[model samples]
Target: MSEIAVVAISIAKPGCEEQLRVALEGIVAPSRAERGALQYDLHRDLREPRRFVFYERWESEDALAAHGQSAHIGAYRKQIADWIEHSEIRVLKKIM
Candidate 1:
């Protein structure tokens, strides 16, 4: 199997956790339907409601790149920016 992934770490503005959750839920379906999306999951910190993460897997680098420009993903980023404090995004390739 191809092994490519993306990890997104986001900190929501104070009191914006629920809003962020709603926004993230809205994008799930579209992300799953994308051409090479193998998996996409959203996670929240158990101890910190304001912290969130997205774990995504794709078939290849090209597929992941395509996701970066996808309409749903773009919309999510734009809409959530106002509710977010900061974000760190990284892409990875499996070695083991």
Candidate 2:
């Protein structure tokens, strides 16, 4: 099966960019170490510092699901619950 791609966008509350960035940064290494993690990347919008984006590729849908239930991810979510203003996640299937 082909890999699954995930695009997650997070927006920090006004004035909480640094706090959000720190929290988001904490997830990258651990997430990359997961069993089925293929690629994990975080990006900051040049025009909007408070906006953060995650691009991830996983071995399968099940793997992606496991990533969501990962202990580190759970912890990260709880840790940043109040630091973020909005978040969106999209799962994609490659076409080419």
Task: List residue ranges in candidate 2 displaced over 4 A.
Answer: none
Q: Candidate 2, residues 1-96: lDDT per residue as tens digits? A: 679999999999999899989988999999999989999999999998889999999999999999999999999999999989999999999998
lDDT of 1 by residue, 2-31 (tens): 769999888989989899989988988899
Per-residue lDDT, model 1, residue 75, is: 88
Each prediction's TM-score against the native?
Answer: 0.92, 0.97
Q: Where is the poorest 10-residue window by lDDT in model 1?
A: 1-10
Most accurate candidate by lDDT: 2
Residue-level error in angstroms, candidate 1, position 49 = 0.9
